[model samples]
Structures are given as structure tokens and as C-alpha cells.
Target: MTDQAHSLSLPRWKEPSILPGFGVGVGLTLTYLGLIVVLPLAALAIRPWELGLSGVWHELAAPRVTAALKLSFGLSALAALLNAPLGLLIAWTLVRYQFPGRRILDALVDLPFALPTAVAGIALSAIYAPNGPLGSIAAKVGIKTAYSPLGIFIALVFIGLPFVVRSLQPVMQDLDAEVEEAAQTLGATTLQRVIRVVLPALAPALISGVSLAFARAVGEYGSVVFIAGNLPMKTEIAPLLIVIKLEQYDYAGAAAVGLAMVAISFTALVAINAVQTWFAGRGRA
Candidate 1:
């Protein structure tokens, strides 16, 4: 019996049961989340219930509302797509190259996160305004950057760059360079090696980054307003429209729009997550 008891596995260092402690921690966490996240979202959703079906439909289907939705979502998607390639290129250089000012450039990628959105908007507006250096050159060609959809896209791109870069950086660091070297040794061309070997490993991170960036840009308000010109049915965005509705004392209308945006953004995020799952499954398979 003694030998059998000794042979049996023993639980590691059980001083006391931690159930009480764990339960308290979990309770606090849930309470905090409820107050901060769930409460605000629930309030937004509940406010729309006061609006009847026709009233809700009228608010949502208004031309200006539709225009704002389209512009915000469309520009956000474009910015994320544009950033994906540019971010990958930047990440590749930061990881693979050892050039002058490389460290400084890498540090600069995170500037948006630290910088206030309002400051970023002001700076971008000044740089791309008609009289500004690049804008002046473009003006000669009859192109305007500020106070347009183009400006909105640029702002989104500015804010979203860090997401793509940070997401891809660690993945790039972990990626084995030997795989590429082997592909090269086997007579793979530059593009062929990159397409076959380099991209597969980075694809998951890239997708995640793109999705995150798109989500962020979709909700971006501060940096876009100044540059977007906020014209109804033109440069107006969903967030601004919601704010406008609130200013008009149309709480239900504002909540309705906010709810719609939340729904759409949530759906997009879900789809992206499904894609990520499929990719993960494929990797395992």
C-alpha cells in the first residue's frame, strides 16, 4: 500500500484552494467590462427601440446617411488594402535590411499610436492643403488632396499603418530565411520565391492586420473631420452623421446609425475571423 501510494502521481504544492480568489477576480473583470463596454453598447442599441419601424427606416435610408456610410466604409476599405502592401514592404525592409536611419524609421511607424488623432489631422491638413508643397504641385495638375475622399483615405492610411507593420513584424522575425535560400538554390526566381515561400507564413498576420486597420479606420472620427470637409452626401462619414443627428436632438436617429455601423463592422470582423480560421485549418492540414 505504501509503495502504491508513493508510485501514484501527486498534485503539485497545493497550499489552499484558489477558487475564492479566482472567482473574485473573474467577477471584478466581468463587472468592469459590463460597465465600460457592454453598458455603452447596450445604451446605443436600446435607444433605437424608441423609434418606430418607419422612423428608423427613414433615418437609416436618408440619402445623406447612405452617402456617409458608403464614404466611410469604402474609404476605410481602400486605406486598409493600400496599407497592406505598403506595410509589408516596410516590415520586410525593417526586418531584412540594415540601412542608415532604419531604426528611426521603425520607431516612426508607431508614432500614430502615440500622437493624438487631432494633431495628426491638423498636420496632414497643413501638408496637403492647396498652398502646401505637395498640394501646390498637385494643384497645378488640378488635383486636390485635402477636403475630399482622398484626404479621408490618407488620414485612415496614416492611422492604420502601425497596425499592419506591428502585426507583421514578429511574424517576419520568426520566419526562417533558410526556406527562401533553399528556394533560391532550387532556381526559383525572385518573385517566385517571395510568392511561394515568403508570403504563406506572413499571410495570416497580414490578414489580421488588414482587418484591424479596416475596423479602426471605419470608426475613425477626429483625423478625418478636418480633412474630409464634412459635406453632406459628399465627404461626410458615419460617425460625423451620428454626431450631427445627436446635435439635432435626434438621439434615436443617432443611435440607429451607430447600431447599423456596429452591425456592419461586426459582420465584417466575423467574416475576417472566419477567413483566418480557414487559413489556420489549411496550415494544420
Candidate 2:
């Protein structure tokens, strides 16, 4: 056959199959992705366009809007930061050690994810209601746990923790114990072994977990509203503000806030991805 004929006759793509052909798989995947992700995101992106640029700017720059945005982003970041170490420790204990009720402890780590956010929020509010046990202790120190920004942070931490723990658990499970044993055999101290051997291996996964938790916390609403007291410019989060705007029939304002939050979360996620890349590179280096 001529080279041109052969080239023309060459297969271009996989043929459809009866059970699970590449064509069927790819078609189904694209269809599902379009319906679930792409369409909704396109609608969201187009929403603020109904507002002129100036209108969107004014909506986002309003005092109440700015305060809610700042509170939401700041508390989410703080909660994710706090979750990193605690989640890592919990994941490590779960992965590395087998103790009494270890299976129960592991199962409980997923409670935040399984529990309804509204129920979690109500439970947290009850626990931190000033007359509640933990709330009473916090009050003794003159710290308000509920109906304040602190309460938002606490609720965010509660909901965000599961992300970090779940993200790290599988990675930690795949890590080899022999590597640590070898490091110790070479006279590496505990701190040195952890720093030089363990942390670099875990850094990428840890950052990813933190980023996931941060993103989750940023958009959290149900579990946060009860604890936030819904005070405008005080404890109200961005999601709550968006809901309030929607309730007041200020659709454009809500869209503007939603767009701003998407922008902020995307920026933070990109920065976190860069950090993850750096950690991955350092591990190779």
C-alpha cells in the first residue's frame, strides 16, 4: 500500500464496545461532567454580567459585603491552618498505630462529612451557647465561642477537619515504615527523621488537604449560620450575606458576592497548588 493510503486507513480512535468501550466511556463522562460541573459554572460566571461592571464593583465593595467576605476568607484560612497539624497527627496515629478502639476512632473521623451541616451547626451552637459546658469554660476566660467570629472559626474547624484527615490518610497508608526504620538505623534522631524523611514526603499531600479544607470552609453555610449570630458586619459570613441578599431579592448583589468569593477561592487554590508543586520538587531534590 502507498504510504498515503496507509496513513489514510490508519485508525483514528477506539471503536465503540458493547460493555464499556472507550467511545461510550468518554461520551458518558463528558455528558456527566457537562451537566454536573460545566453548565452550572457557566451559569454562575454569566450571572454577574447582568450587573454592569460598576454595579458589581459597588456591590462587592459595600461595607457589609466587604466585612462578610473578609470574615469568611480569614476564618477559613485560619481554620485550615489549624487543621493541618491536628489532621496530620490524627492521620498519623490512625495509620501508624493500632490501639484500643482504633477502628472506632477512625470511623469517627468521618463524622463531620456524614453529619448534616445544619445539624452540626445546631449542635455546635448548643455546645457553645455560654451556658453549655465548653461555652461556660470559655466564658470564664471572657471569650465568647458562639454568636461571634470565634464561633465561626470553631465551626469551620469542625467541618474542615475531615477534609484534611481524609486527604492524608490514604497517602500516609501508602508510605513505607521501612524508610523510617532505615533512617533510625542510620542514627537519625526522631526530630531529624521526621523533618528530613517524613515531612517532605507528606508536604504535598498536607498542602492539598489544607487547600481542600480551606475551600470547603469558605463556602460552608448551614453549620456556620447558627453559630455566627448573623450580625451584619460582625459575625456574618459571605455565604450568609449571599443568602440574605437572595432573600431580599437582590440577585445581582448576591451574584457579585458569589463571583468575588469564586475569584478569591481560585486565587488561594492556585497559590496552594504552587506550594504543593514546591513541596513535590523539594521531595525530588
Q: TM-score of every model?
A: 0.90, 0.91
Best by TM-score: 2
Best by lDDT: 2
Each prediction's Cα lDDT score? 0.91, 0.92
lDDT of 1: 0.91
Backbone collision tally, model 1 = 0
Error of model 1, residue 217, in angstroms: 0.5
Query: Model 1 Cα displacement at 269 (Å)?
Result: 0.5
Local accuracy of candidate 1 as per-residue lDDT tens digits, 1-285: 574475454554433354568667779999999999999999988888788888888888989999999999999999999999999999999999999999999999999999999999999899888988777888899999999888899999999999999999999999999999999999999999988888877888999999999999999999989888888998999999988988999899999999999999999999998988887677667
Q: What lDDT tens digits, residue by residue, belong to model 2 across residues 1-285?
A: 986676677675533234766776789999999999889777777888788888888888899999999999999999999999999999999999989999999999999999999999999999999998899999999999999999999999999998999989988999898999999999999999999999889999999999999999999999999999999999999998888889999887888899899889999999999989999998888
RMSD (Å) of each candidate, 1 decimal: 4.0, 3.1
Off by over 4 Å in 2: 1-20
The number of clashing residue pairs in each candidate reads 0, 0
